[model samples]
Target: MEDLKVNDGIVSETLPGSPPAGLESYGFDQKDTKRLLRKMDWHIIPFMSLIYLLCFLDRTNIGNARLDHLEQDLNLHGLQYNDCLAILFPFYIAAEIPSNMMMKRTRPSIWLTFIMFFWSVSMVGQGFVTNYSGLMATRVFLGVFEGGLFPGVNFYISQWYRRDECGLRMAMFFSAATLAGAFGGILARGIAEMSGVGGRAAWSWIFILEGLLSVVVSLGAYWAIYDYPDTATFLSPKERHEVQTRLREDTGHLSTEFDFKYVRQALTDWKIYIHMLICMAGFCPIYSFALFLPTIIKGMGYTANDAQLMSVPPYVCACFFTILASYYADKYRRRGVFLMGFQIIAIVGFALLVSSGNTAVQYTGTVFAAIGIYPQIPLGMAWNSGNIGGSLKRATGIAMQVMGGNCGGIIASYVYISRDGPRFITGHSILIGFVR
Candidate 1:
């Protein structure tokens, strides 16, 4: 490894600037470092939350659009919609490693902004698609752009935050999924209600408005987000030294190193497969809401508008529980038990949804499913983040986790077939069993 001096510490990779002083080397004083890391958390969390919120909103607006006539207009049948959903994963898997590799070499600011812009364009293009083929192509393009986001954010957070702080920070970031789950429903309903104002379908309006929103947010992220601790031009040299020393102290290991061999080892290891298995098992329930909740809400004898509006409440409930769960998980510093506990709650919720005939009861189950499963996601990510070290390896590990969980995205897309609507027993059963 190449050694570069910054402040009083030796970094594995050097930045191109004059060094600052007062950065303690590895084995620094613990209390001072802890205080610095807490300040760093304030800088990191909001930036990550914004990106992930857009990432989730873009991925999931499809569920809201389905409530109107997206399926009917395109003449989709049986597994055709599911098939469109499935196509994204192959491209997502293909792009995962390469995107992270490129992000590592290039600055995250440029690459991540480029990615957001592409997805925003794809989201806008989705507004114009007239057929299943066009929608399919757009979804694929969306996947190619967005596949890097979660992994990239994961890698970025790991770079600055310490092991313990990561749990809460990651929780706040991943809770964007829950927030999108909550608020996207409201936003979609408002947008969908704009139908015929300019001679367009509600679904088209949904796409156009959301796409434009993403485009605006991407512009701000380019200015607000930083690459790494030492390279942050916005922070003064003293602040950079404080960040470097603080993170190293928090992790109990040097953070400046980039290790490719560890990444290869992470890829080949059997334990990582177990981690993948856990991700697959849980991610389905989470994604089913993203891809199918609007349809499921419509099955409950409500108008399209009512269903869209109703979708908001369940996700809002999810946001509350996700935050609550994260706060407690961080307070206790426990992960596996928390994850398993939520899975069991989710299993019960799915069971209730499948077996209950009452619409209100089933809706209650929907709320539980979101609450039970969503919070565990960030907790799981923080758990995995703490276990990995070095920039390249951490990036690869996070990418693997995201790809594994998202593999369930394809399964989720297919699980709720139109034929199985009204009583989506097969899909719910599969989701319930998978969580176990």
Candidate 2:
């Protein structure tokens, strides 16, 4: 099949391993494109991933802090911990679509850094929470600030990469959060070493020190984050144009302009709601894993420190599998079946978790959780955005779906009550259905 540019109806007889013809007219051959992509990889992927890593860590680090007696310290009883976790989402969901749209109206460099700094402050503030109300107050602010970053970053990256190339990049961003699970464990265990320092508990240190890094990184982001491909200070003019040309090959016209019609179209679209269901399916389980893995691992009868350390491996495994799945999905440009197919792994894992009495067997199930859930959520987001057209509409659609999707986070908070420990059959059984 010939590669056709729809707007001009220019057909290119493309050979294998070459970019669509006329990329050379912009001095963007396959080699130049690959070079430019690596440059983008260096600039965008790691930096955004670092920010996401910290955000994800801050959001769910309570799972680790719980291992250090966060419940006992605050007199948290029964479902208070669960309810506290749930409170963040209402504010988070309320803020996301507005936040996503705001990032578009202003510079992402301006909007996102503001978002990041405030959330980092919330992260730091969690360390000082002496009671339930204090924790809830900080979570309210955390929710309002943290809501913007995920959907905003998803839209930001979509601007820089073509649809077919986005799956792996999206998964890499997902992998950053998984790496945070691994890194969070390492940090949690190390922070445990500082338990009595300055009259603060290890859990307090967990919130303070990890949150401090995000605060620092957020400050530097004002300098580091590029607004758009056209305005990237690090890129040569030819490189920037070449990047734009590649995106244009996928989309005929790039309109960054804000229009109410697109916003209204996104608001009323039934397909966006269907896509929201897909987001819920993937995300409910991913959030379940993130917010409870340490507690879940400890239920397998390992020591608290050992459970903290043990949570690391499954995330490491997930990061590898998640990237591999996205790579092939992007390579083929057929992401539709990947989410549904890989989800079976999670079902099987959960089934093992529910039916098994053995600790090692259940540990294996946790490993499978990441393998399936981690990749599916980001791939789900990529699938949602790739189907939508126009940057404004895509951002709007993404924000809507993400806001709806995080309803799963609220669900996730309540699913694994502390009483369901040891087997946690109810939570595991419920997880089997989330992917389905």
Candidate 3:
């Protein structure tokens, strides 16, 4: 080893990104780091994935609830259902950057717990809303609270893992969104069957039961979720030092301290807007697909109940392929290049959906769209956060990109309006443009 140095017995290779030649000099080795990585994965990734799954489930369950007659009960008029979904984005988009900045000051466990509690409240309240205005009011609060979590998650992960290691971890976290899509269909199918139970409609049950589940999980999260590696109670003092040391060397500058300089760095970096453009491409199609998959499936001649059941397979395929893509992306250490290739897959999927009238063809398009749409989220997340240096800069950039993506969601909500249904050329064709 070339002149090794150790801080608290944590060491790295002589050059960052080189093989770890000097780890053993400080009583650390490949095996020790591997063990540490495994511990970190267990302590962090799955719980993050679980809460995010619930977060996504709560947001997109409106689609499922719609199938259970939300519109009929509310007497939603033309474009009103779409407006309800659209109502979420303004509060959601506006909150992204500020929420991340707020999280910077608070322990993530406390901050995340606080938001989760309120969003769950908003969700459960949706079940009790009796009219269009009531429904709209609940969605506004839902948007405000749910906005913080994703950017907070990206910031949290960036702090926990180095750039090279982030792709797979982000993939694992984002795969929960796909699983929620698959799982939501099954849950909705079951819940929708509970119509008229407890004097509640099936649509109401979708929100109430799911929201209550989230409420319980949120309370549990405060206890279960760990803070930084340094403060984590689960790790030994030695391992905590080791984890922090590894993280310090990964960045060009240690991101432990926040500065207004880094905040300005993120905002003024013009390249981030390019990343935001790509984010727009990735998120627009995804929100549309999630919010309307059942509607689209039902448009394909299936009953509402059957539509709920059938939405599963595409999302299952998406989860599998998303994990597969991230593994290879991490292994190869290429992001933008691999992403362009996958974008083509989604463009093809949208083309099939837009051009074909065949039911089998349309369903195939959905699978292609899901596989293509889902992977882009993690790919975009990892690519954006990995390139940004400071924790604060990463926080701002990721939130900015996500905010731009929310703009896509606004577009998505309106594109699938009922007038375009049965062969929503306007929707799928617009989606084709988005993926491209």
TM-score of each: 0.89, 0.94, 0.94
lDDT of 2 by residue, 1-436 (tens): 4431211211221122334433544466667778888999889888888899999999999899989988889999988999889999999999888898898899899999999999999999999999989988988899999999899999999999877677789889879989999999999999999999999999999999989999999999988888899999889998888888777656656565798788887888777787788788788888889889988888889999999999999999999999999898776555656777789988978887888889989999999878978888777777677766778888898898888789989999988987888678999889888888
> What is candidate 1's lDDT per residue for 224-282, written digit by digit as tens?
77888898876678768777876765544544445577668668755556666677776
Q: On TM-score, who's better, 1 or 2?
A: 2
Instruction: Assess the local accuracy of residue 248 in candidate 2 as a C-alpha lDDT between 0 and 100.
Output: 69
Off by over 4 Å in 2: 1-27
Q: Model 3 residue 395 lDDT?
A: 87
- Cα error, candidate 1, residue 134 (Å): 0.6
Following a full C-alpha superposition, what root-mean-square deviation does model 2 have from the true structure? Answer: 3.9
Question: What residue pairs are clashing in model 1?
Answer: 7-20
Model 1, residue 338: displacement in angstroms?
0.5
**Given candidate 3, what's the lDDT at residue 91?**
96
Score residue 138 of candidate 2 by CA lDDT.
Answer: 89
Model 1 clash count equals 1
Q: What ranking emerges by lDDT with the best candidate at the front?
A: 3, 2, 1
What digit string (tens of lDDT, one per residue) describes model 3 on residues 293-375?
A: 99999999999999999999999999998988987876666676668778988998988998899999999999998988889
**Which structure among the candidates has the greatest lDDT?**
3
User: CA shift at 89, candidate 2, in angstroms?
Assistant: 0.8
